[model samples]
Target: MAGGKLTARSAATTKPGTHGDGAGLYLVVSPSGGRKWVYRFTWQGKIRMMGLGSADVVSLAEARGLRDEARRLLASGSNPIEARREQERAEAGKPTFGAMADAFIDNKGAEWRNAKHRAQWTMTLREYCGAIRSRPVDEIDTEAVLSVLQPLWLEKPETASRLRGRIEAVLDAARARGHIPRNEANPARWRGHLDKLLPKRQKLTRGHHAAMPYAEVPGFVASLRERDALAAMALEFCILTATRTGEVLGARWSEIDMAGKVWTVPAERTKPGRPHRIPLAGRAMSILEKLAEGKTAEFVFPGQRAGKPLSNMAMEMVLRRMKIEGVTVHGFRSAFRDWAGNETRFPREVAEAALSHVIGDKAEQAYRRGDALEKRRALMDAWASYCEPPASNVIKMRKSGGGSAV
Candidate 1:
């Protein structure tokens, strides 16, 4: 509980991620690069983050005061997160829309890709949403949301669209936290609610990243197997699992279930903000095994810095070093999809499930409760086999004549 390790200067300069301020208080930088104050504590064996406020809004001193308050609540056998919520209910007469938005950003810090993303959320919710900021979250009706959006809707189509989505997300989070009535339809809901009111702006056709042909993946993976560097192994695992770059880079040892042979991508770390369990085939497990040897950091693919995961650029640098051009790390998902659809007997839904794609509407999902984990497990195993045949054990290609290994 000793305090004051982080100075204002150090706090400002620290890279995007959490930094301890002692006594469970932390300065958390979202991947998009906004700063938030949080108190990390345990309740019944599960660690929870109690958001104090955004660092922009709450000074370090104020955050520490909030943390002390939370600590006192915890000492008195109360869960700080729940206690904080209760305190708000009794004292604040329901959280303001601005407060809920801040909380949503704080909670979603990890899922954001970078500083630009953080800025967009901050800008839209803070500057654009000024009209409704102080309004009680539960009272935020469709017109309140529309007033903030309509001005920018035609002038800045992309920004307005994203703002609408972010607002919807905040309302959704509000409903989840019981700040708003669950039965009340979201004021920012897109399809049935906003679609009728807001005219569809002209759309742009976004191109997918270039993909390496599925036929070429095995050879590319073999090239990857030739190196033992963390980035190389990380890239190989990314390809094998058909996961996103951020997911692989953000993967932590805590999320790995070696016994179950699965990597559980937590809700906060996923694009959809849903937990995804990826089955690890033997080849993928072998990559993890290689990295696990002598691994001491929390991140399985540890970066050069102590206790940090590899930089977002690290795997891309691997591709650059290999002199491979045209294809992207994400494009591997396309290759995997092509292979699954073209070569295998697996159902399309099973293939999509393997990629953690959300399929079907709420009603269909309700009836089809299972994630098809077992079927996907078999699908992933076959995909892994295609990438690197199990019998060879990913034979390393050592260099000849005193050169670096291939």
Candidate 2:
């Protein structure tokens, strides 16, 4: 304990140690700067320290009053700390967020496609989730998750989005392992949860979007094919090619090479501002062919305007049309990424290039300048097949009038 009695000013500035007051009341600052008020006293002839509250929340005067109460109880041969414990009846604490995150990485890290994946998880949890790292996994609520996200959510949207996803993943693992109650909804959940609170992430992302779980994409694709709108086709095309919304909407016939089975997105339309050559999957080719016939406009998915491409909100409207909930058009890229990373054997570089993300340090990026087109083509093909509509729900696309349910 520090030798001198602490005033409010000294207590706030005190370094990591126990700062004392006159009669067993103290402010204990941990190495991480977490300060708590404690009442040090004798309980049943053994020394005991009872937590009053966090120093941030509890005042020195209140702590002194609590110390006085403890002294009163001590004179009466009662242990104030044990009495408080009995009154509170606190639950046994579960594993902390940091410990759970460490376990999650150790268990799931091997399944990740790249070594950097582990590093990303580790760094995000350690740096971004520091507020909740010491909190029990079960104790993490929406407020706690929001505390970690709200500050970074705007300025560093990409990092904030990734950190939220990682937190959700660890909490999900905790739930599945029975660390949390089975019926408890995850606080870090994005759709219908955090999306309701934070700024719309679509406008903030750098072509990287919040993802729907990959396992549900195929079913969602099947639902999309049932619609007849051009916007529906555009959304499906975005998924099949694993390209961004603007890239899919802004595509022109000139960019498509039917013979080569490729679509060359010009530098202007891409996220990285570099021309990207995407090999067409058979499903994607079919989508192009279906949209091509009886097509009079230059843009693949044209708006009602004289020569303009489809409005960016068109696909989002398609979601509303279908009454689909909790999914976004750009999120398909993330779903595609998740599928490639976890379910496929394709190397991480191929998947990254397919998404137009120029990963790796400068030299590694320079060495990987080829874009790994053919390898990515294979990966895209596999992903396309994975997203194939269920046979029972197939709605054939007629060349003239769009999709028909017959």
Residue 340 of candidate 1: its Cα lDDT? 94
- lDDT, candidate 2, at 116: 59
Lowest-sum lDDT 10-residue window in model 2: 397-406
Highest TM-score among the candidates is held by which one?
Answer: 1
Task: Show model 1 residue runs off by greater than 4 Å.
Answer: 1-205, 389-406
Residues 1-406, candidate 2, lDDT per residue (tens digit)?
2233778798788899888887788889999999999988765336787898998998777778878887877665456764554344335546778889999989998998765566667666764575577677888999999988886686458878998999999999999988899899999999999999998877774533445677777877887877787888899999899887667877889999999999998664555657899999999999889988857567788765434567656787787666655556667777888778889899887888898887889888777658778898899899999998667745432211111110
Error of 1 at 388 (Å): 1.2
Model 1 residue 158 distance off true place after TM-score fit, in angstroms: 8.7
lDDT of 2 at 94: 69
Those runs of model 2 whose alpha carbons end farther than 4 Å from true positions after fitting are 1-208, 393-406
Q: What is the C-alpha lDDT of each candidate?
A: 0.78, 0.77
- lDDT for 43 in candidate 2 is 50
For residues 216-292, could you state the per-residue lDDT of candidate 1 as single tens digits? 77777887877878799899989999997767877888999999999998765665556789999998898788778
